[model samples]
Target: MTDSCIQKQLTEPGQEGPVTVSISRQVMPGCETAYEAWISGVIEAASSYPGHQGSNVLRPSASTQNRYVLIYRFDSYENCQNWESSALRGQWLDKLDGLVQGDAEVQRGTGLEFWFELPELPVNKHPSPHKMALVLISVVYVLVISLNLLLAPILVDSGLWLKSAVIVILQVLLMTYLVMPRVTRLLRSWLFK
Candidate 1:
């Protein structure tokens, strides 16, 4: 962790929704095992905190240039901030001394922003709002049309609100776990250009 990282997280107020923090660090030679143990402990500690959704560890890969990425999520920004500023987290950061080559780079994202983030790329800049809106609109339009066609028969007898709710829940789930990730990767060049 860096002073700037801590300062920014402490001073800035985040939006009220799910928030994710990506911590990227390059481990010192031969310190991989220790770094792994440290990360496990910290993640375990984090899971005990309020609003902890879960965490995902991206181990060093060829494309990532051997940098470990720890991505953790909280149900809301306030809870995430609480865990980030906790003494337990500080103690975990203290143990990072000499284990890593440099101060970890941290990136925070909420809502749709995380969809635009590329873990392999360190560039913090996000696609412009118009571009994101365009992509989202295109994807959502297709989803809506396809879903309505597919579910019309099944939901024909259902009330309007119930049918709408089903479509929205499915859309959200598919967008979050399926479509967005693949679409983002496919359009990375244009999106990040």
Candidate 2:
């Protein structure tokens, strides 16, 4: 396959930029903590590498076979590759010889280390997903409230505090009960092995 910087790559008929996610499992016994620490290092170290966008680490509520998901969102396939083969991670991978399985993504895909292919996402400037999700939810709620106010001025409540409180409560309930589960599910796929 051809490797090219995603930003410079022209959009092709059937090709799309990828948001690659890796789901790897530890092979040797008693190295779960080491594996996680090493993967976490890889995620943090990725920021220094080219095309590095952002990363998320997922661990199951209970450990079974020692699995972890490392979701690295990159600017392009080329950037992901640059991060993968860099000296920044060489030692980390080498350290995995007796800890993690030799095959990077054995059960995650046919053979590739990556699990899922997402349409290219613009690099997020936010350091936290909660912040990003909150901002988006807030903006959408504001738009809906504004439309309601325009339609019926009488519904505008007496106290802004009360209205704001109501919104906050509703958002919290929705987020806790509805949103977090889906995020957990998406991250869990990385441990299919």
Count clashing residue pairs per candidate: 0, 0
Give per-residue lDDT, candidate 2, residue 171: 53
What ranges in model 2 sit over 4 Å off? 1-15, 60-66, 106-193
The alpha-carbon root-mean-square deviation between model 2 and the true structure, to one decimal in Å, is 11.5
Model 2 per-residue lDDT tens digits across residues 1-193: 3555555546653244544555545456677777777877877788777666567665633432345556666666566667667786787667777776555442211111232222121222112335434544564576556545653454375476666665566554554345444443454344222
lDDT of 1 at 175: 88
| Tens digit per residue, CA lDDT, model 1, 1-193 | 6988777546345544688899999999999999999999999999999999889889999866789999999988899989999999999999999899977889988767777777877657678777899999999999999999999999999999999999999998798779998998999999988
- Looking at model 2, residue 116 earns an lDDT score of 21
The numbered model that scores best in TM-score is 1
TM-score of each: 0.74, 0.47
